[model samples]
Each structure stands twice: as C-alpha cells, then as structure tokens.
Target: MIRFCSRTKLVANLIPPSISISLEQRHQSIATIAKMSDSKILIYLMRRDLRVADNPVLHSLIHNKDHGFTHLLPLYVFAAQQIEVSGFIPEDGGKSPYPEARSQIGSFWRCGPHRAKFLAQSVWDLKDGFEKIGSGLSIRVGMVDEVVKGLIESFEEPAGSKVSAVWMTSEEGVEEKREERSTKNICDKAGVDFKLWQDEKYFIDDRDLPFEDPKDLSDIYTTYRKSVEPLREAPRPALPKPEKNSLPPFPTDVPPQHSPFVIPTKYEEIEAALLKLINAQPLAKNPPKCPENALSVHPFTGGESHAQERLEHLITSGSITGYKSSRNGLMGTDFSTKLSAYLALGSITSRQIHASMSVFEDGSASDDRYKDLKGYGKGENEGTYAVRFELLWRDYMRLCTRKFGPQLFRLGGFKAEENAHLKWSRLDSPKDGFSKEQIQEIVERFLNGTTGMGFIDASQREIYHTGYTSNRARQNVASFLSKHLYIDWRVGAEWYECMLVDYDVSSNWGNWQYVAGVGNDPRGNDRIFNPVKQAFDYDPKAEYVLAWVDELRGVDELGQIFQAWTINDEERKEELGIADTDMVKNPLKRIDFKVNRGRGGGVGGGRGGGRGRPPYRPHSGDRWTGRRPSSQDQGRGGWYGGRGDRGYQTRGYQGRGYRGRGDRGREMRTGMMDKERDATADNE
Candidate 1:
C-alpha cells in the first residue's frame, strides 16, 4: 500500500536464461538468478506520465528485487475513441475538421477539427516512441478498469513473478483521484500489489506540499509563492533504456493498439485543421510554415527521446541564458520555454526538467560556473532564479487548476460590466447611432488601418499576417475588442485560444477573466488602451506597422495616410498582394465617404479598400509566403496547433519555423491564430 522511495532511478537488467528455458537447458548461474527472490514483474499502469525515465513506479519494481530482471508490464488504454466514435459534425457546424462544425463565435466549445487531428497524431507519435525503444504499446479499447484487470490476470497466469504487483502513482485533483481509485480497484480485484508513488508537487514530493487538500491551498498567489519558495531541489533523475528481452507470456491479453509510449493524437490534427479553417476565413491570406513532426504540435516531442533532445539542446545551445530578457516578447520561437504543453500532456515530467535545471544553474546560471562547465557559455551571471520563478509559476497554475474545476471553464462571471457592451454590439443598429454593421465596420476599419485607433490597427495586423502578438498587445487587443469594438470577451478569448501557440487553458482563461474584469483582478483594473499613444511608444516608427498595415506601406511619414479613409474619395489606388515592394508601399488607402456611390455605382462605388479587404496578399512576408500551393493541402491552423496551428513564416523565417503538415495551409493558421507574435521573430 505504501513504499518509501529514496530515488526513482530506472536501472536496466536482463533476466537469466533459466527463467525462460527448462532447468536442463540453462547454465547454473541462470538458475541462481531465476531462483533468486528479487526477480519480479512490476505492473506500472502508465498515466499521463508516459516517459520510461525517472518513472518511480518502474524504479520501485527495480529496487525490490536483487537478481531478477526488472520487467514492468507497462500498459496504456485508449479511451477517447469511445467518445469520438459517436461523431456527427453538428449541423450548426458544432465542430470542425469533418464536413460540419464551424462556429465563428466561440466555436472552441465543440470537440471538433482541432481536437480530432491532434489526438490522432499524438497517438501515432506515442506508438512510435515505444517501438524505437524495442517495446510494444498494447492499446485496448473499452472500459479502462476492465481492460487493466484483464491484463493482470493474463500476466499472473505465467510465472506470476513481480508482474503480480500493481504499482500505482499518486495523482492530484478530483478527476485524477477518481481515476486513481479506479486503477486501485482493478489491482484489488486481481489481488495484485498496488503501490502509489508520491509526486506531491511538480518537482517536490507529497511530503513537501506546503498544505494538503484544495481548501488548504492559499487563495493568494503571492502567499503560495512565498511559502513554497526555497523548496528542496528535485532528487537526481535516472532511467536506463529498457532491456531487450520481453516479459514472459502472461495470461492478460495486452491491448493491440496501445503502444509502449505515445503522446495523445489530439495535437497533429488540431494543427492541420486549424490552418485549413483560418485560410478559408476572411481573416487569413497566405500559407504558414507548420510545426514539424508537427503532427503533435508539442514542442515536447512527446516521448523520452524527444524530451531529452529538447532538454540537452536547451542547456547546451545557451537558449537558457537570455531567457529572462526575451520571454515576455510577443514574437519569435525562442521567447519562452514552449515546453509547457509537453509538461501538461505528461510527455516529460516536471521533476526531470527540474533536475536538469539544477545542473544548468550550476553551469549556465553563473559565469564562473559556466567556465567550469564547458560550453557553459556564461551561466552568464544572474536571472537564473527568474527562470526558477517561472517554474514556480507553472506550479502555481497547476495548483489553481486543481483548486478550481469547471469554474476555470466559465465566462460570464467576471466581465459583467462588459455585458451591456456585448449586447449593444449585436443590435441591428446601435442606439449610439452606429449601424448593425458597426461592429463589422469597426473590425474592418481596425484590420485595414482605418479605425483611427493606431494601436488597434497595429494589433489587428499582428494577428492578420504574422499570426501573433505580445502579452501587452493581447491585453490591449482584448480591451480594445471589449471596450472599443464592444465585442464580447468570450469571442476574444475563443480567438486567442484558437490562435496563440503558447496557449495554456488555465493561463489563457485566467488572464481573459482578469482583463475582462471578471476573474482575479480584485482591484477591478478593467482599463482601456489608447491605441494611438501605444503606437507612438511601441510601434512609433511605423516599422511594426509597416510590416502589417497595407496603406502605411512605403509612406515614409506614416501619418500622411494615418486616416487614409477619412475623406470622400473613389478609385484610389490599392496594392493587393504581398510583394517586397508592395509590403513597403500601398495595398489599401483610399476612403469613399459617400453614403451610396452616385448612380450606377458598384461595390458601394469606391476604391477596393472601401468595399473589401485592402488586397488579399498571398505573401506580405508575414502569415504565409504563398497560396495553399494546392487544394489538397487545405487544413486549418491553430497554435503551433493540431493539423493546423503554425506561425506566419515566410521563406525567410524558416529555420526556427514550424514544419507544416506539408498539407494545405501547409498547416495554415486556424482556431488558435498563432497570436503570440513575440514568440517568433519573422524573417523580414
């Protein structure tokens, strides 16, 4: 029921030939090990934590026996299919990816295209990970408890060795508790020994939790921070590659499809579907560079090998040094530790990374130590603690998610004040004298750099082409969307969730509430962004503006056409494509102020600007470099998302770029608009 673990080291050892061969066919030494008391099978029921390294359940099995091969019957059951098989794309377009399910307003709720694509891809990647290490993933469909029970029964039919034990791991929150209990029941019915390893905190164990139970958690983040600070470092993490030999044939029938290891399939499809959807929408123009292997959209590669690859790369390449300075920026790939998704998915446990960070702190966190560590490249003095602080923050969000359940899924609670504003925007005609078309008119104005709100216009383009923006821009945009555009905050949250590559459910929903004056801003800081002044301070030279805004291109003094659509004019010039010169010049500038163009008018009787988008630039050197390249590739894009999510990457921005599914949109931008502009620097 309980076991003390000094370490979760995974050691590799081969079983003696005597165990498999008859007594007459084996060497004396083989019999000695086979008869030795230590040989056993540890049934480590794999959960979200799929990696073989630093797996405590595996370590426990290894430590208990002295001579036997440490063979753990690791099992994973595929269950999402049970839920998805009932799939019918809703007529209202309740979902995405399939023929139905498309919602411009918070369509995010339905488990549609984005989710389907990602899940399928993740499952495949997970299977591959296991095979690479010489193990097989036994995927079983049906009730999880029943399937696991059958596995133990089958394993016991053989030697009944250590496989007789059911070694379980501790989990947090209600859902996890429920799942944990179900696992225990399976082991109980099978008369197997179930051991639960403790991982109380992300890196620290349960004994180290400052408090127990959700109620014990301090409501204030600062309080939790101060109390949890100066915590002990993680235990040394170690895992040997699994031995080459297979476990003895047990009575249990292992799931055929479940691989030894796999990241869920939700990632890739989500990435592709997202891209396809976005390109088709009026919002997107060109194709984007997609996520590589990109199938899972997890910067975390999902399996042990991929996780280590990133960790080693992180420390050796010196990406960890300038972290403090670049993390908050809105555009570029290296701006932040994109590993959060992997951590959440359980591809790479936080403890392993924590251990790796300590090694990094000594080497890269300080200059003197850097010189000592070789390729240390200046642990470069100071701010390593800041990185540590981020880890702590991640811990905090997890705590919050645990403490608050479906509440984290709510929307109307915090933004009540904006409720009225939301209502008016939907009206056919605003009592304030704007037409029902006002919202779209305003949205169009903002996108076209004609809103007269410089900041709003700049930010719109941020999402328009590059498909990203800074936290500052996000806050500004949300406020502008709510306070200025009078659009619902839910609409904005959905768009952000759909676009941001770094989108974290907790952080995204949490921040949206805070900004909309609903979640945690107790001070009620629901403020507005002065679009023009912000442009002066953040995008003053019009360089950022020049990168996105169609009309401002080539206008040496941007103010010359700051409000290009202000005066009555028709037949004005329009630059409708993404050319190096056009990106630098005119794409949309003329304003047709006439209520209705004089008799015999078409398209409202004005330059293309007044009637439609500035000019659908296939490649303005931002979102995409060209069209879908072909219809066969038409998938949606989200975050560095499923089948669809990837950032705006011109040929110039290719190196740190996402590997598009090589399909339509080459993984074009879709649901999650890849809005964290500061995450990746564009090629231009």
Candidate 2:
C-alpha cells in the first residue's frame, strides 16, 4: 500500500536541475538507463478496480510522475477455469461418484451468459477510456499466472525494455488471495517489484476504524455498526483524468507516429481481439443480450460514463432525497439504487458515489422543494446517512473476508459457540431421516421454480429471467430454501453465483450465511419468511406474483388463485386455459405450516428459543391432489382470510382480472384448518 512519491520524495528533490548535468545530457542518460535496465515498463494488472478515475492504484502511478516510469501496460486476464467448483461432496468420509463426473464436465462456469455480456461491455469500456489518454488495454484469456510470465519473458531485456514492476489493487476472496500470491511469486522470479494497494471500492479504510486490529472486530453487525457510525471518516476526493499531453509523446521517425505507451501484442487491435474473446464459445440459435433489460424497470448499461450519468440522475432528480422510503419496493426502477451492478464490476466506484452524495446533501438542504419534504428522522441528513449506512455493511462484509479469511467460505460459518450443538445435513446424501432420493427430487423441483409455491416460484423465475431481483425477494427465496426446504445452503449460494449479474463473492456468501443462521447475525437466528404473508404484504395486489407466475396470471379467481392446486378439473380448465383432461391430478406439496407462519428454528436454534421442532416430513408422494381437501371439508374460510368471490381491482398491475371462480372456490376454504392441524402433527 506504500505510495511511490512518499517513498522516493527525498531522492527526487536531491536531483534538482541546478545540481544535475545539462538537460540534454540528463535526457540521454535517462534514455540509456531505460534501454539498459528496461526500468520504465510498469505493468498495471487491472482486476476488480477497472475504472480510471478515483482508482487508487492507477491514480498512485499517474500522480508519481517522477518515479521514472514512462510506459504503462494495462492488462486484464479472463481466467474462466477459476470459477469451477464441486457441487456437493459429502463430509463424513463416504466415497462418492460425483468427483469423477465433475472432472468430465470441464467447464462448470459460474459466470453465466448475462454476467459474461456485462463483463465484455466493461472491458471494452475500460479500453476506450485508456485510448483517450494515448494508451490501450491488453486483454488475455488464459491462466493469469502463466499469461503474466509469458508477457514478462516476451520483453527482450537487451534490445527492448523489460517489466520493472507489476501493480494491482489488493483483493479479498480466497481465490483472489491465491492469485495475488501467485503474482508476487512471478514478480520475484522475474526480478520485478510487485506492489498491491487496498482499493477503496467499499468506501472505508481500516485505518479509520477505531479498532487497533481488524481481527478484534466483532462478527455481530450491530457491534461493528455502533463503533463506527458516529466516527465515520469522510471519503477521499476522486482524482481527475491525466492530461492528454502529459502522456509520453509519439515517436516521429516512423512514417506513422505511435504512442510510447502502446504494447507490442496483437491486442492493440482491440475490437477484433476483444470480440474473439467474448464470443469464444460457439453461438447458440439465439444470441444473449444484457439481462437487466429483460427483468428490470431501469436497464443498466455497463461503463464509467453511464455510471456517472446515473449518479447525476439520482441527485438532481430528487431520487436521493426519498431513497430511504422507496428502497424496499419490489417492482419499480426507483425502488432501490440500481448502482450495485456497476459497483460489482468496478465500472463505478464507492469513493466517487460518496463524493457525489456530499455535494447532493449540501445543495439539497438549502433548496426549497427538498426542504419541504419530510426529513428521514435524522434531521436533514437522514437520506445521506442511510446510503452511507448501507455502504458500511458492504465494507463490513469485505473486512470480514480479511478477518475471517477462508472460514467465510466454510459451511459452518464463523463456527459460533452457540451453534456447536447443531447437527446439520449436507443434503447431498441421506442424513437426519431424509433419504437421498427425496432430497435430490425436492431440490431439483425448487431450483426449477416448480415446487408449487406461488410466491417462491415467481421470485425464482424473475431471477432466471433478469439476473437481478430486489433485496426483499432475495431474502424470501433464500429463507424458504434454507429454512423451510432444509437443503444445503451452499447450493443456493452457488446457484446465485451462477445467476446474479451483480454477484459479489463477499456480499453474496456473507448474506447467505446470515440468512442461514451460520454467519454474523447476533441472535443466531435465520430469517424465515412466510411467502403468502410476504406476497400479501409487499404485493398486496399480487402484481409481482402475476408478472412472473404465468399459471397464476391465467386463473380466474383472485381469492382462490393462491390455492390453485386444489381446483377441480372442470373449473381449472374453464378458469385457466388448460383442458380438463390435462389438469394435474396430484396434490401440491404442502408448504409446512411453520414455514407459512414464518416460524424460526433454522440450523442454529432461532427466535423460538431451544432447538425447537425437528424439520417437517410430508407424507409419501406429497402431490398437490393428495394435499388438497375433499369436497365435504372445503366449506370453510380461505388461506389468508374471507371465503369465496372477493371483489378485486388491479391498482398497479396493468388492469387484469377474473370473470368467475365457480363452486370449487368455496370448497377449498374448508381445508385451511386441516392445513394448520398438519402443521401441529409435524411438530409432534
């Protein structure tokens, strides 16, 4: 993390023009030294911190002009093999056939089509930015270590300049750490220096924290929050782009002039080179586009220019003024700040956003329109503080990665003393009375969004289509899978890694652990969400559910649609477009009573106190037909409230409705009590 200028200040000042040789002689001497030792070549190994402005590592080199570096090589390596992971290997020492199968599958790529598209866009954007400053980016597709070594060796030390140093921003995950160590080893062997600096992408520095040592920081978020909230440091100002003329002048001897910073590789032709790498795989019948456009209200474009434009809109459009109130919304473009996708890819930076917030706060406090709006409880600074508070959570996750290291990746996260008594399952093999066959069947259904739970199905479908979902939807789906379904949390985490465009290693894993009762939640309680209640509460009109769930959208009864699996053949065909003979005969799998009520007794004994009830086990062939109540028993109230034919109006859902529900809607109401009874029996 050392700055070049700070380290060499004395040496630079001592070599003033008054005491040195003539300017012409000095230039010749520097040129001779540069050719002799190849000391001017600095390789900037661009990783997560991809932007030019406010990028600490890049800024450090550009600022310390007297460090004798005249040429810079900006390099990015696309190492696809790094993402491969074994899906589920048993921990109890039993032999499994999965290891051999995984080996055969060569590419279990976690970065899916959507994220791949976003990544290509970002790399192209970065190359454009470099071109503006008389430089170009070198993109290679291979193992980072091997490619870097080849790049260093290709530099002929006698005739051309060799690499003097390699520079990159410090990273946090286990794989990133391994890459960093490999880079250091490569530099050591090549006799080149390796410099790593902490990237301020998460907005805070460890030096600003009150703790003497970062490891001493608590796993509990509240403790960490309380210690730093009032004492938070103001973010550093973002740096300006280097002047065009400041770049090394072009060589004039050649017929066509060229910038000194250009690299010798064929990557100089960026359009052709980048396109080859992006489309390395054979094209499908249909080509993939950016995922955000399909599922999100506001489509996110990848680039620093777009990032800056979005930030300005948030401030000037008064979106920042009301962020606190609208952040939890599930449907709209303005529901939450859509900056996360850009932040994950480092297209935009936290420092730049923080600086923008400061300006917005100062300006808006005096404006008449903003002054009249209700302050978010912390006086006039609530909106700004709220945004900062969220940023702190992002920082906490990153610091936790440093403090806990590889433990964050483990299934039993942090291994809190309170969780010692629990005996958890891997769900890949039989354990705790659940058979392997049943587990696999259920998990497959859940992943495919065919578990027959309306709310869960909709959320999963949205994520599959968009590569993005609201935080609320994420919590509900995660809770349902880990708590109610009782499957391996890692599978869900990995699935998210494969799907989410904004997936961050630290944030995604850390959040999964928190929801699964395996991470830093002080209560040691996993969050259990009741999908029915959540759907009713968040999407009161069932608009979100209707949008993603096609089956429910076609159903005629607004009130009875929640229990659509119970409908008789004749009514099902008339209400929905399906034929009477084609109606699914089996009952929907019963969503456990405890799950419907949102009871908590997740892996680590939750809010219900002691270890509570064992996991629920439904009867054999727990199909939708068997689970539904018979005609005689269906004369009671509906699942949530009321009986048949509840009048409905579409407020925000583009105005769609049902014409009829038939007599079967009343019959389905009688079974609500029976469902509650089944819940009691499961607890026993």
Candidate 3:
C-alpha cells in the first residue's frame, strides 16, 4: 500500500458528450468552469491535513507533469457515521462514568463538545487560509468515500477536459486506512484516479524510516529512538502555498445545508446547521481564556498560523532550551511545547517544527544562568534534544499502530494472548463487594473530579473542564482508574478519545493500554501510581492542587488536603481556617484565599514566600484576537471573505481562542482575596 508518486503529466482529454450529459444529471459542474477552456479539475480531499502550507498532496496536484488542472476543488467531509457508529462504545445501561448514549439518526454519536468546537474553529481557519490563496473549500457533511463518489459522478468534464485524480494525505488509524481503501475502490469503479501521500504529521516520515520494514520497529520506545537518532536525516523541508494561478476558484452555487461550502460563524448556528445535516451536534463553544500570566496553560487556538506562532515563540523566547526539564510540568502552556493539538489536527507538519528547531539550535546563543539537567541527552542542540526526543516517541506510537493494525484497539492490544490471564471478567452483583455499580460509582466520581484524592481530582477536573491535562496528570488519573479501581482500560481510553481536544488515536490508545498493563508495557502487570506521593512530589506546595481544587485553597497542611473530602465542612473550615462555602464545581472560579487571622494561613502559609510564584506570562502581548470570524451570520459567504491580507495577521492567540464551553465561572474571590490571578497549568 506504499504509494510514492510524482504528478502525472498526461495531456487532458475530453470525455464523450454522451457521457458528459449523463454525468451532468447527477453532478452539476461549476457554471463558470463548464464554459472555460478544456483544463481538467483536481479534487483535494482535505482530511487531517487542513493547511495549505507544506501540503504534499496539494503540491503534487499543482505540479502535475501535464500542468493539467485549472480547477482545484478542496473538500472536507464531516464523517458523522465514523464518529458516532465506528469508534464509540456506549455505557452498559448506567455503568460507565461518561454520558449516556444519545442516538443521532439511529446511531450513537461520540464526539464531545470541546473537540467539536475546536474542530469547527480549525476548519474555519483552514477555509480562511485557502481563500487567501484564491480558493474556497466546499465543505460536505457525509462519509468520505460516498461523498467523493458523488462528487466524481456529478463531475462534467469540460468538452475536452478530464478529472484529475482525487488526492488526500494518508492517516495512521486502521479505520482511516480502511476508508482510504474504500475511497480508492469507489474511484476505480467510477474510472477516476485516487492518489495518496504519506501524512507527515510525525517528525520521521514512514517512507524514510530507518528500518527496512515497519515490523522491525522496536516494541520499546528507547530501542527505536536509539536506532534512529544516529541517522540524523532532517525531515524534508516544508513547501510554501501553491501559486494562485494553479488554484481555481470553487463553485459558489453549491446548494446550502446538505452540501454547504462555508464555515458557520457562531457556535450555536454551526451546531444547529451541522446537526441538521447529519443529525449530530457540534455544541461546545470556545473554552474560557486562561489569564495572560498563566504560562503553563496551552492557550490553544486551532490552525496552522497559530501553530507556527507558538513554535516561534518557544524558540525565540528561549523556552525550547529548558523544554526537557519543564515539559512534564502539570500546568500551563510554558511547561512544554503546546503543539500536540496543532500536530494532531495536521495544522502544522512535523517537518516544519523539526526544520525550525534545527535552525534555532544552530543560531541560539548559550546562557550561563541556567544549569543543564543531568541525563537530559538532547539532540545535537544541547537543550532542544528533548523536543525531538518527544517527537520520536510520537513517531514510535504511530509505527506501533501500523505494525499491530486493528488489534491496537482491542482490550488486550497486541499482546492479547500473553496478557489473557490478567484480564478481569465482569461482575454485576452489589452483594459481591466488587460490583459493577460500585465501580461505576467510582468512575463517575473520578470523571466528576470528586474522587476525594486532590491530585487525581484536580487532573480529572482539568480534563473534564478544559478537554486537556498534563501527561503526568493523565498517567496518574489513568493509574487510579486501572490499578486502583480495576476498570477496563478501554473505558478510560474511550472517555479520553471523546474528551481530549488534542486526541490522536494511536497515541491516546497506545498510552492508555500501556498504563492499564494490557498493551506494550514490558514491565508486565505492575503499573501502580501513588496519588499522595505523586501530589507531594509534583506539587509540594500544593499550588497546582489549590489552583484547580478550590475547596482546598485555604488548607494549611497541603499534604492533608488530598483527603479533605473525608472531613465535614464545618470541621474543615475550623481546622483549615477558611470560610464555610458551597463546593465549587467549575475550575474557572475566582476563589478568595483569606489569610488565617491569628495562626496565619493563605496559600503556602508563609513557607514558600506567601502567594508562592508570580503569575507566569509567557507571551508579551495578547494571543487570541486575529482568528475569530467577524460575525455570526448564517448563509453569509463573506464572514472571512473581505478581510484581505489582514486575514492572516499574527495577533492575539491566532485562530478562535479556546474558551471552555463559554460558561463563565462563578466568581468566588472576595475581600482579602481581591488580587485575582489567572487559573492555570497542564504538563504533558
């Protein structure tokens, strides 16, 4: 299935008028294009790769040896069935921690609110990006293979024109691979060509892997990393946007609703429109913005421009140097490069990041102020090696999926037979002590961030609220779910698949299986993480715990606060010297931390300089202003239509800044806690 291709240069030929007339009845060709010269049309089937920059498929399309295409129709299919019916598994009755199943046209839909919102924003930004290059994306809502077939059937090649091939970037998931095969089958039946390029989402291109066969990739990450690090073959450089002449304008006359080609402006209108099209909802609004001072928060905005800016900021600000040490920080954007979401969506290519890193490493000046962490073996560049190191880890996960195929999605993963004895059978009776009801209750509490363990709750609350958390937080919470509660790892994996804004199939499931002791953990079935010790080690001052878990804000001995749920409110207020207040559910609230009047209490109790650390502002100016569509008007093709060059301005968090579900947090800060700071941090 490896397809390495260059553009075909064959001369365009006209299909007979007889065939053209028959095709016309099914698919109406663009009026303007129908009358134009006999140049053919090329459909760019946009999938994960949403950007115009560094797109190999688009590049090959335009550079076809014949230079044959005069029309490049960019399309995106909202695969409703794929999201609802394929990857998701509903709870057994009321036994799962996540939401109950909701049917959309007889099938269950699994995409959550936050991911839906982020995806909408990313697609909108993508449309804007394409328009700048003098083209429009014809967004369709349906299964990809069927949509492509319909488009091909309707295509009336001009009197002497032919349809060039349909092109798309390859995907790593088994389902995506199946869809690709299906798409090619449809194309074969229709007598049209289908082409694919290796998706360069990872730093090491699959075609350029050091191993001769994918099966040769190590089962362990370290072994794989050691084998590849020495080759030092820099990723292929990114290509710039194609010339405007090569991009023909999209048809503006496509019917609305079922096949509308424009980005919906508001969350509700878009939600409603998408629901009507496929009987599914995209209801989540943008998440709330973290305070400007919260350096550790991702402050994520979807799209390629934002991805580039974040990468630049990391390099120029010298944050890349300490990346190895700070990458695991449990909170905030500065702890690690917040590029995963961008990478996951294909907004930015891994080659672009690696290329940029190489240049930065070569040009960066050394500083004597910071000490290098021991054992932080980086790339040739002293401090940046860890960034590449992480990219290699991402590469290995993708390779793992490729090697193991669909089995990666199963409960036992690749080692099903080997781990058979460790699998626990389901138990339903409450009288048995380990009943499903009890386990479900525990899962519910974990999902709601009420597990009574401060470290675990804060991490869960972060993901439940923000659709994100640090890798450390994920591991800790996952350990609690699998090792402590002994729930099926698939449940947590599926929950994460629905919730995480940066969800990637291979990485998410692979990591979950690893922790659950069902996947490729050579360490065998002994994956245990102590929440208390983890809290003490990662958050000794309990600043992170207090930031997300408001109830523990006034507790003096932070160590004891992990189990604060065991204490009655009146007892806690008296013991911890805080006001008696209702439990806060939202993390965006403004909680007032009053100093203990007599004994002394307020954040670290004067042990770590009172308020602890000053707010960490990573960027000099605002980062969220440029990407939001100007109006929420429905049926308007001009929301981003007339912005001109300013459309791509690099200002205030480029693209629509993620504002968590747009529900304002309850304002709880008052009196002595008047000094309000941004709530922040996530490290993964």
For every candidate structure, what is the RMSD over all alpha carbons to the true structure, in angstroms?
Answer: 15.0, 15.6, 15.8
**Per-residue lDDT over 1-684 for candidate 2, one digit per residue giving the tens place of the 0 to 100 score:** 423243243333334565558766755554554444433577788878778777766666666777667577788765534321121112353432222111111112356545655666677788788778777677665457766787777663343456777888888887788788998899899898898877777666655676877688887766777776562354556677665545433221111101111222332243333233324542211222232223565367667777788877776666776776666567877766777767877777776777777655555344454343333223336555656666767777777877877766565665532332232334433234544444544555555565566667666667666667777677667666665555556667766765677777778877777766677764334234555445544554556666766655666443223334545556655666633311133312443222222354422212222223334322222212222334543453221111111012111111122111121111111111121110000000
Model 2 TM-score? 0.70
Q: Give the TM-score of candidate 3.
A: 0.70
Best candidate, lDDT: 3
How high is each candidate's TM-score? 0.56, 0.70, 0.70
Query: Which digits, one per residue and each the tens of the lDDT, describe model 3 over residues 653-675?
Result: 11221122121111122110112
lDDT of 2: 0.55
Residue 463 shift from truth in candidate 3, angstroms:
0.9
Q: Where is model 1 more than 4 Å wrong at Cα?
A: 1-47, 66-105, 109-134, 139-206, 231-303, 364-382, 412-503, 527-684
In candidate 3, position 618 carries an lDDT of 20
